[model samples]
Target: MKDQAKLASDPADWSIVETVDAVCAGHASALEVTQAVLDRIARRQPVLNCFIRIDGDRALETASGLDAARSAGRTQGPLHGAVLAHKDMYYRAGLVSTCGSEIRRDFVAQTTATVLDKLDNAGAVDVGTLNMSEFASGPTGHNLHHGNCHNPWNPDHITGGSSTGSGSAVGGRLVAGSLGSDTGGSVRLPAGICGAYGIKPTQGRVSRHGVMGLSFSLDNVGPIARTARDCARMLSVIAGPDPMDTTALPVPVDDYEADLDAGVTGLRIAVPKTYYFDDISPEISKLLDSALAVFTSLGAKIVHVDLPHHDIIGALGNAVGSSEQCTLHDFWHQTCPEKYAPLIRARMQAGFGVTAVEYLKALHLRSSIARAVSDAAFGDADVMFLPVLRFPVPTLSETDVGDGAGLHEILGSINHCTRPINYLGFPALTVPCGFSASGLPVAFQLAGPAFSERRLFRFAGAFEAANGLSDCVPDLP
Candidate 1:
């Protein structure tokens, strides 16, 4: 499998597919790719605070072994030698899975996360776990415990959370990609603000076993990368049914890249007329309009659709997620409430005030709400167009919703467009479309029905080509 030339010396310049091809074909050894990534991490870590730790020694050892296997004329899997990391929530046996909380700061796991296992089986190297918002609760990237993850584009601005490190690492080109769990817009928010591509598959598409549960019903495991194709490749490797997780679907996983370039001709794309664009600034609105034009230019039909309950959908979903999160962290809340961040602790405490009848009602209404939103948003469309953030990326101090300086209103608007998708349990893709006035990244979302990752990727890949935004990388000062 030897080839003509090596990939770039810096892993920051290589995408997942490029690294895989270069390593497997002998144009570049796995160690070379691993070393390049480690080097980039070393250079960027201090500035970005993206990683809680770096398992550089283990990554190098793994890379050397993979190189040996290739030399012995054996290839393990599709992602052989490609480097990737994940948020701190994904457990690794014998390693600390902080879940970005003081309560579990020193806690190590006895079992490895199924998602991490799948990535290993596919030959992807796990470099380390990333920093995240405490227990995946916050929308902004503020973490009093682990330190906030800084945006690579402008460290002063927020990276968005709780997948802060996943987005920063990929957008900063420290690694090809990383895995993130989205209970509320955890994955998509960072992907948007960091100017990267992220996909949160259907709730049942990927297993959540071995991953710390924030909101069991709302939790979803997915990938964040520099492009939709990279996301598709990772999703193909990590998605599918798991015996370990009954919530995982029995439906077969499709080849996400198969039709990535398939023209969007005659494809129906829906745009919401209700809550998505409400209160958004002119700059963000203009960016969305420009993106819609690109979709039309790609021969996709833009159809108007409105989810009448988008307002209630987000709030109701929050109530359900908050209740579920309380159940998961109940022990800690009862025994050592002092361990949690003040704001997160308060939210957890609020969950107890939610009576059994209220929680049951939310759960009972969940299905009907999901169906209604699905019908309104995806009933007649192949893909739905939505906004990620309504305004320019705010400074870290401005969006600290816990500080109680009018940030609640800012935080309220941030998730109305994303949490509703989680409630519906559908797959949503966030791809960078343009930049806000502050020069921070701006992105639009495309979602499809349950387990429709292929359709989302097809649209995302097409829009990526038309928009030409994925190739732009952050130039950290």
Candidate 2:
């Protein structure tokens, strides 16, 4: 193996795939690629605190075995030498899987999550576990159990979570890619704030088995990467049916990497003049307007649509999510209440107050709203464009006080434009559009009908290509 000490001294030399591919093609082993990522993590972890755990020794062993097998003319998978990270909520067998809470700090599953197994089978090296919001609940990336993960773009600002570390680590270039869960825009919010690409795949499109549940109805496992193309590539591997998750749809996986350069000509796109554009900073509004202009310039027909009852969807989404989350953690709450974060505990407690009749009514309301949204916005359009979050990341102090009323107000504001689609179970992509005046990243989302990730990705990939925003990386201190 190449000298680990030398690789540890230089991380940028092995940060992107283009660099690793060139090195690997010239006989650099998978072990070398894995070591390079470990080396980078060593350099980055202290500053970013993006990872909860680092298993470099074990990763090196796996990489070396794969390299040895390949040396004997054995075939490996598509992501043969790629190194990736997963959110701490994902269960990797024998690894301590802390779902960013004291409740499950010592929990280790006997079996790995199907998504992790799929990535491993595809020959991707698991470099480490990224940080996340406790119980995958909050919008701001504050973790009372682990320290708050700072945004790479601006360490003083939030990273947007429950997928906090996934966004930060990838944006900070600590890892090439990472997996994140989205319930109420967890993945996309972080993607927007941290200047990364995030995909919240359609619910049940990817298996939720082996993941710590936040909201059974709304939780989605997806990818966060530096570019839309990278997100697509990772999705191709991690997405598919899993017998362990009966909710997983039996759909065929496509070659997401192919035809990525395809433009969005002739596609109908809509901009909803509703909750999406309300109350956001004027700079964010202007940035989104500029992004929409790019779509118009690329031959996409821009249409104006309205969803008058959009506000109800956000209310109903929170009710359903909170109720479901409470149900998932009833035992923990009853058995060890003190272990739970006060913020999460309060929200979970609110769930008990939500009656079954109300939960069922919320579901019915969700369906009605989804149908109305589809007919009004997506009836003639391939994708809908909107702001990912109404605002950019706030400071850590603002979010960490466990002030339930203030946190709810802020989270509700951030999820105002995002939770509606989660209620409807649609796929959404958040790509960086511009930066706020304070140098915080801002992003706009592309939402598509159920199982229309390909279409959404095509549109986002084109927008990314034209905008060339992926090249903007955070200059970490």
Candidate achieving the largest lDDT: 1
Report how far residue 234 has shifted in candidate 1, in Å: 0.8
Compute each candidate's TM-score over C-alphas.
0.97, 0.94
Shift of residue 5 alpha carbon in model 2, Å: 23
Q: Write the per-residue lDDT of candidate 2 for residues 1-477, one digit (tens) a residue.
A: 265653544443343344334344544677767776787788778887899988888788878877877777663575666778889999988889989988888988888899998888877788878899888988888888898898888788889888999989988888878999999889998888898889999888999989888888999999998877778878988898998999999988767666567888888988887678878777778888899899889988998888657757777887898899989898988899988778778766888889999998997777677777878888889889989877666888766758556767766776676778889898998888888888988888999887888888888878888999776777764
lDDT of 1 by residue, 169-248 (tens): 98888988999889889999999999999998998899898999988889999899998888999999989899999988
Ten consecutive residues with minimal summed lDDT in candidate 2? 11-20
lDDT of model 2 at position 107: 89
143: Cα error in model 2, Å = 1.2
TM-score of 1: 0.97
Clashes of 1: 0
